[model samples]
Target: MAGLKPGAPAPQAITVHGQSRVLEIAFSDGAVFRIPFELMRVYSPSAEVKGHGPGQEVLQTGKREVGLLGLDPVGNYAVQPRFSDGHDSGIFSWDYLYHLGSQQARLWADYERRLAEAGVDRDAPMAAAGGGACGHHH
Candidate 1:
């Protein structure tokens, strides 16, 4: 995966805290993060969320209470989460997870800004999918 960096710290432990809606991950380098499911859903690396290129991103909303239905490993490189809302295409590489964990605050701020610009409530229900590029990969 292009997102995986050389010598990146590998996860030592990964726990899904269903009650709190967070994915707690501990890295080999001793960095631990409790990433929220909502954030992961909103910032999913899948084409469904990121779209095909720049300026094509689909803003995600109403994910504040999103829950993880499952967490499946992707070989030795990443984890694919099955969200309660039926999103499961995102395969988050270790480096990407680390980035999310490390940059949570900045990402949240960005998401908030996007919502504000769209004049949408943070809890506004997402529009039905299939409005743009498909998430299918060849």
Candidate 2:
């Protein structure tokens, strides 16, 4: 990973709680967080969701029940999650995960705000497959 931040706390352990729909991660710095699958899906750092530039983020919806089918290691710095919805593009780094864990509350609030602003419900269905911010159309 070219942009891996220096001295970031690496994950010492990561547990996928399918029953609770949470990812329990313990870092080398002794911080533990239970990150929700939905949050990860909504905030996926992939080009699909985040697009290629600022202001192009595609808001994700109907991901409250999304599940992690797999969490695969990417070399030594990041993890790629295979979501139940078949979204496997986001490569979450250690620092990014930490940021998500720490800022979850704020992020949720922001998501809610965006939903309200768009007049869309939190559980609204997402757009059809192949029609996303990934710069590809089918």
Candidate 3:
């Protein structure tokens, strides 16, 4: 299905389902989606995730346990979700959120496949684990 149409009703309520690590949004149209934190992180619209252009997307692994750190509204059109992984650049618009909800299954499958193709060991050290920290005092 297509993304949210122009003039479409925005979410009437939004809740961070921390226990389930999902963000639940009930749109004015009565459509609700439970988006997993992992999905939101990997699919972030930030430059860190999307990169400068095509083929520059950084593969996000080891984020199955990530959580939503916080959220801030952007005008009347979007919200920026700060992730536990220190990612807070993606400004998710209403249309983009709708797109994500509609494409969640396929996008998640692709993310999983890419992780496998990259041979990223899921048990690898997390970024917060001091992975490759130089520890330079400059």
Q: Which candidate wins on TM-score?
A: 2
List model 2 lDDT by residue over 1-138, tens digit each.
385667889999999999889999999989999999999999999988887688878889999999999999998899999999999999999999999999999999999998998899989898796763465553
After the best TM-score superposition of candidate 3, give how far the Cα of residue 130 lies from its true spot, in angstroms. Answer: 12
lDDT of 1: 0.91
Candidate 3 wrong stretches, greater than 4 Å: 1-5, 126-138
CA-lDDT, candidates in order: 0.91, 0.91, 0.80
Please report the TM-score between candidate 2 and the true structure: 0.92
What is residue 56's positional error in candidate 1, in angstroms?
0.6
Write the residue-wise lDDT of candidate 3 on 86-118 in tens digits: 878899988777778778899888987887898
Question: Which digits, one per residue and each the tens of the lDDT, describe model 1 over residues 24-130?
Answer: 99999999999999999999999788888998889899999999999999988899999999999999989889999999999999999999999999999988875
True-structure lDDT of candidate 2? 0.91
**Under the 3 Å rule for N, CA and C atoms, how many clashes does model 3 have?**
0
Off by over 4 Å in 1: 2-4, 132-138
Error of 1 at 31 (Å): 0.5
